[model samples]
Target: MDANREIQAPNSGCKHGGWVTLPFITGAVVGLTLAGVGWTANLIVYLIGEFNLNSIDAAQVFNVVNGGSFVFPIVGAIIADSFLGCFSVISIFSCISLLGTVCVALTATLSSLRPTACNGGSGSSCNHDHPSSVQFLVLYGGITLASLGQGGTRFTLATMGANQFEKPQQQGVFFNWYFITQYAAYVVGATALVYIQDNLSWGLGFGICVAANFLGLVSFLSGNRFYLHDKPRGSPFMDIGRVIVAAFRKRNFPLSSMPDDYYNPITQAAPPKKAFRFLNRAALKVEGDIRSDGSIAKPWRLCTLQQVEDLKTLFRIFPLWSSSIFLGTTIAMQASLTVLQALNMDRRLGRHFKIPAGSILVIQILTSAIFLTLVDRFFSPAWQKVTKKSPSPLQRIGIGHGLNLLGMAVSALVESERLKTVHDQPEPTPIAPMSALWLVPQLSLVGIGESFHYPGQVALYYEEFPASLRSTSTATISLIIGIAFYLSTAIIDLLRRVTRWLPDSINNGRLDNVYWVLTVVAVLNFGYYLACAKHYKYQNVEKEAAYDTCD
Candidate 1:
């Protein structure tokens, strides 16, 4: 077998020096995340403060930008799987990201690129001056390029790092550290970078991001010789397409009950299992399907039983995947709105240090990082000891769904209280009398839910997806997040048109009603998730067993 084929094999040996590339890869992850989140964390504030956009418009822009960031990872994953491999793609996009960050920094430094300040005002009283077309295009161009670069690098980097390890144990360790680095970066970006932007200067803050991007690119390139480069085989998506086409073409053919009748690449194994049996016809032998050399002559007309089975596995998991979309949508909407809420509430901590509105998100990232460690270190093992089996991915995801619903409920209650405080104030102040810390409970609950579901989703996809699509499997989370953000934007826009729930000044609008709607949607989504989870079956039972053992 060729190198690419060997790499794709389940039992492939590690050719490169194991763990040598870990530090470089982890360093790059931290740097890239720092750069990416530095801008993204404070994006809404930047749009409102620098671009002079209204609160609602800024939130919408933030969602769209975040959605794009998530969407581009699928493109990156496809490119990594089909054309340029992960290392090459990461290298190319890293450079692109650095350039984009530089452009963003320039916009902050050069006053001409951004709109004038909103009459030097602090909050709702600020004048809402729209950016000129030229200014808007430049700003958006920078944001777009930066977002694309971030999308291409984030999950693809994880897959590339994981590829260096042959053992499942070591791979698990790498993933733990991978997420740790990512969340740590988010905490720093949300708190430190945001503080700098709010206190010092946007130019200085964005300049730091530019520096981090450059450093990350350099760090990634430095580990070039140590990395095990997985070369691009054809796109896995193409194989999925081929399976569907072949299955449909053979719809009239009858499936055989005997193992010998169906096409199995491995001579020793039994025929594909009974589920989705209609698809089994694609693997049924027909005259002229095979060449004299035993190769597939008409690839589109005939597929291996494994291909057919893999397609079925994807189909089985899709409803589960679809159900997670609304979960993410709720989180996305809550995150954007929480920042706005923080901006309106009293954000003081001590005598001198007042939290930045953008920095309030750091609470969630910090909670997730802490809880993730606790779960990995203590909770999983403890659960296994009590139950005699580690918790399944579906169970963990279900727990996440429940916690998410609770978080939405808490958010609705908090918003209601904040609105009451807003109404009770004798005079209209820029800030509400309520403390920003009230948002922490909902944010922390969301974080804890993430600690369960994010890893569960990644593990489920990685375990269930075919080896050929391993990289793409990891990127699937990004795809869902992207879609959810877009959906959230649409939902927000729809609400604005139809209801009084989300307006420019949330204090003047029924913001709590929006959270209540989300809570209801989340409850329905959880029901859908339960149904999907109960019916779904694992394709690789042995792999899941091994994963459980490793945990």
Candidate 2:
């Protein structure tokens, strides 16, 4: 029974406590870089074009720019795993981003060299339509380069940060802190960049971004000694192909076909030479000497190809985290549409003073900072005790999806109110202006949802995937986000066509209709999320073995 219960234990030994701090520093760098490429560049572009581009134009153009990060994660993940490793990949990308930032800032500052229309280029704001073809190429090219660096580092940083705390017991706590800090980075980026763009010159704002990326490079390089520096797996193309083949075989295999006797969990007498044999107390019939927990008390074998294949099979059948895609879309709108919407909002603080519309972004950051304290110092530990069974990372993710629905619902209400006011009034006037305060509920709901979704997804992705496939698994999550961006685009278009009753007068390039559409999507996504939760179950393999033996 002891032999049956004891299989291979996971590689959980690590005495490191401060390894996570390094990533936090690196995360700040990422935050700054994101501000530069994502926020500062946006302001610069708008200023250069010096035109009143509306919400739709801003969302669409930004989507085109943001697409690079989504597309690059797969590349970054593959490279990080196969050759560069996380640290090197992160450093190199930071440096590249710094260069991209410099290029854009210089272009903005050197506007006298080209025609005014081309000053910023053909877009809303640019300096000198690229001075020449070469300048234009260089400017746009710089943006793409920055995207590569940001995307590469963004995908790897969180995973690498989590890697610092390796033990299972510590992993949960470590991840909690890990997620808190990461979300905090977004908060910092959004708030800080918005302030810079609103108050400071665009050149200064972008220069700050460049400096942040440069500092990120320095900080990441400084931490070389403490980091684990694990070798990244190469591209998963071969693995993906193998997975497809195996899936096809499973479909073609006879219905009567049973698992191979040698691989069968029910009849296996001992662990395969390299496979660990763990006793499962959950088994009704104890095939061997069972310990108190009905588990083998010692390690039996190492991992084997067969066991690896079996694990692969387990991964293949795992239910799709379909609802997560919606959560991603919700958070993503902060980057894409939310900024556009804010731009259209009345930024009047009171009489003579008006806040920058972008300044509202601070609300998200402050909210995250507040929530992180509450969750880590209060909610997480307390919830752990109350549940008796520790909350599965995926469950946290599910709750996050629910929150996303609530967030979008709030956003829909605010937009609906704005629409009503605009329709009833002669113009968008201060006397009957839709209160900017309404955006508070929307932002707050998003913050709460983010508190759950981002952290939960990070932990769930890493904990669920086998080590050999970590890079691909992490990258896939980013790819899914990218897909969601395109999906949002499609959703917006569909809403516009479906609501012909809305009249072009209302939608007239405003995102009011689209915001409501997102709300419906969020509600539907929430229902789908519940279904997904019902369909899935988490497998803490180590704990399962322990429980099997004790039972």
Candidate 3:
């Protein structure tokens, strides 16, 4: 089949491609994201206020929830690639999300599902009642369903939307808009829904989320007739496994210089590159390996060169991927800690208005959204004009690493200043006199870094991955983020056990030390990333040109 050909949906007259599906897809993305982020952004606050959890416990729960949300995408992606396609997976998850949101809304409306409010005191000192076992079960059940829904839909939607377009340039445009919608939705959720929850009522806030989710699901279904449905091509993981087994079986086979010595399913393309040469033995044909018709007779003993090359692609990319894990860890830590910092700091913008601690993360989301537009529209084109070629994914990622380090440094400095304010007070108040605005610069810097790396990583994975693993390619970033969030939780636990840097109360803890530690880690990770990028060669140089042309 031609790569550009669109697969027609059964019993649908709507033609694939053009602007017909974009609006509906974009609308669904907006609604789903808005609903998902609305509840999650204020989760720590919700736990502390309604469930009467401690600061540390709330933060840990938030990290775990975020981790679960990201990690679930891998499962969703695999199901899409191996059985049901993206549309089916998304529809099922959307319904799951609605049910979860409804349950959460009921919890807010029914006092029995939440613990009584704590009396005025430091969260550490307050003798607050914990949620009952029944309450805990309901809360966990709601959040678990919600997290699974989010994980299934988030990156899978991006892949689905991109699949509608055949041209890589068109797909690139779709990704830019997809991220723009995602971050913009985060800004709204963190700001508007958070304010409603903080000021009006939790029930009302959660009700809004339920409505948004319903709308998303409905809008997605309404566009089913127009979608280009890709049929499942079986499990990519199994192919990878076969390659490993086949290579081991032919361990003693000597590599030959001629192209014909190795099996090439597509005879026209260049032979597999020399990198990871040991794996090439898997494609080395022996007597009885190929039948009369040129297909493999002993599947476990022989494989096509493309299969071996696909496995090698994963090996080449793993180092770069692993290096990104710590960068994500640093960002996750900053996200959770900044909220705590805001909770303790003076959050008032003026006499009439005060910022919700949970909403402070909106600064990062807003900055990322703005920078994404600028990069897509201005910076990339400007660079191309001067250099005669667009910035490569590795180069964009390198820039992101530099900015991420800068952001961490800024965080350390701001924390140091906040600590100084803590010490200078003659009598400490519950909230410090230092303004929360001091946290904005660091968040903004991180957002700018994200603008560079997030899309770069997406484009890299989509272009490099095996055709059968297209959906999984986009979800790989989600996997990194999920691991990072889990690692962030582990790191926090270790800090609490071993050092005084991450006490429940940020006022007395050496929070500055945490940021400094993250900064150092970022520096080391960036060095490792540089080494990986320098040594790497593009597996799909022509496809990379398509991305460059789009940029």
Report each candidate's C-alpha RMSD, comma-separated, in the order given.
3.7, 9.1, 3.2
Q: Could you estimate the TM-score for every candidate?
A: 0.92, 0.73, 0.92
Residue pairs with colliding backbones in model 3 are: none
C-alpha local distance difference test of each model: 0.85, 0.56, 0.84
Q: In model 2, how large is the Cα lDDT of residue 388?
A: 58
Candidate 2 wrong stretches, greater than 4 Å:
1-54, 112-136, 159-185, 223-228, 232-237, 245-319, 350-353, 380-388, 427-432, 470-475, 493-510, 541-551
Candidate 2 lDDT by residue in tens digits, 1-551:
01111112123363232554556455555554454444533542353343233334445545656666786777776776667766677777777777777776665566642235423222333322324666666666677777777787776776566556556566456655655555555556556665665566656766677777777777776665556555544444544444344334334332222222222334544423322122111111223423466343321211123333545433532444566676667666644555554544566777966555555656765675687577667877787677655555656666677777777777766766775676677664322365566688778877776777666666666656655565466566778687677666665556557765222223234455566667777788777766665655445667433221101
What stretches of model 1 exceed 4 Å from their correct place? 1-16, 120-128, 252-261, 268-274, 540-551
Candidates 2 and 3, the one with greater lDDT: 3
Better of 1 and 2 by TM-score: 1
Candidate 3 lDDT, 217-298, residue by residue in tens: 9898988888888777666887898889998998988888778888887675566679888888888888889989988898
Output the better candidate (1/3) by lDDT: 1
What's model 1's overall lDDT? 0.85
Candidate 2 local Cα displacement, residue 512, angstroms: 3.4
* Best lDDT among the predictions, by candidate number: 1
